[model samples]
Target chain A: DQQVKQNSPSLSVQEGRISILNCDYTNSMFDYFLWYKKYPAEGPTFLISISSIKDKNEDGRFTVFLNKSAKHLSLHIVPSQPGDSAVYFCAASEANAGNMLTFGGGTRLMVKP
Target chain B: AAGVIQSPRHLIKEKRETATLKCYPIPRHDTVYWYQQGPGQDPQFLISFYEKMQSDKGSIPDRFSAQQFSDYHSELNMSSLELGDSALYFCASSFGLQKGSSEKLFFGSGTQLSVL
Candidate 1:
């Protein structure tokens, strides 16, 4: 059972445009969500995260919005750049669950310059 | 400082053979995690070690085991490997397993294992 799901397998957008990736979760116990970006032959790097207490969090050009009632979350990258092309994974964990995370299948983002 | 480092960037083994992968977490980090990633799929959790003890284990088979030493280094061992075990293995670390905190993870380049 995949508690976290990223429905879109891939996405393409023009450079300098806003790129949105969506994720949904079924576990209500998950209180923290995170996004990671990975390039070919490399490990995933941390991008941004959001807490259940807050609805939105922004860091530089990346913004994460959460909707508790709908059990949904999204990551928005503004002014997408070619370097931003990679696989984005959404993960979640409960506070006392020993920080074990359940991850989505991941969405491949391609930015065309 | 260096991030997580995994040794043996690539390895090949035959069925029923044993393979070992090593990982050194970031200096001073207490949490180490192992994950397996297959082609066109996301990474799946295998196990985690904190402070030299097994913290959690995923639904992986018994053939897969992990150990952590005092210096915060970890090792993954696979006995009687099967073709299904062929994939990319990753190691990660965090300061602590706290929720709602930075909880940022530093990952290694990964070890590509091919079981023949």
Candidate 2:
């Protein structure tokens, strides 16, 4: 059973425009959420993360918003750049889960320059 | 800055053959994790170790075994490999075992194992 799900398979955006990727989760035990960006042949790179206590966390141009009531989370990249094109995987882990993350299927984002 | 290290970036083996993959965690990091990503699929957790002990388990197959050495290095041994076992195996490391901001992982490039 998939506890975390990324509904969108792919997304396209123009350079300098905003890109939003959505994700949903069914496991209430998850207390921490993270977003990772991966290239074609490389491993997933850590982008940003948010704790269950907070609704939003921002780092540079990347922002993650969480809605615990809805079991949903979103990652927003402002003024998307060409380097932002990649597959984004949303992951979650609970306090007693021993820091192991459960990942979503991932969303491929393409930024057109 | 040093990151997680995975050896044998690529490997090829025939069915029923065995393969061993290695990983070296970052300095001072006590936790290690293993994940597998198939073609066009997201990463799936396999197993994890903390301080040379198996701390968590995931979807790892029964034919596979893993261990973390005292030096903080890890090895994954796959026996009687099948065609479906071909995938990118990634190793990640973290500083802390419990919650509170040390759980973030830094991953290696990964080992792409192809079974013929």
Model 1: residues with Cα > 4 Å off, grouped in runs: none
iRMS of each prediction in angstroms? Answer: 1.8, 1.8
lDDT of 1 by residue, B13-60 (tens): 999999999999999999999999877666888999989988888866
TM-score, cand. 1 = 0.96
Candidates in order have lDDT scores of 0.91, 0.93
Per-prediction share of native contacts kept: 0.62, 0.67
The 10-residue segment with the lowest total lDDT in model 2 chain B: B95-104
Which DockQ-derived CAPRI band holds candidate 1?
A: medium
Tens digits of lDDT, candidate 1, A6-99: 9999999999999999999999999999999989889888899999999999999999999999999999999899999999999898768776
lDDT of 2 by residue, B2-102 (tens): 88999999999999999999999999998899999888777899999999999999999999999999999999999999999999999999887877553
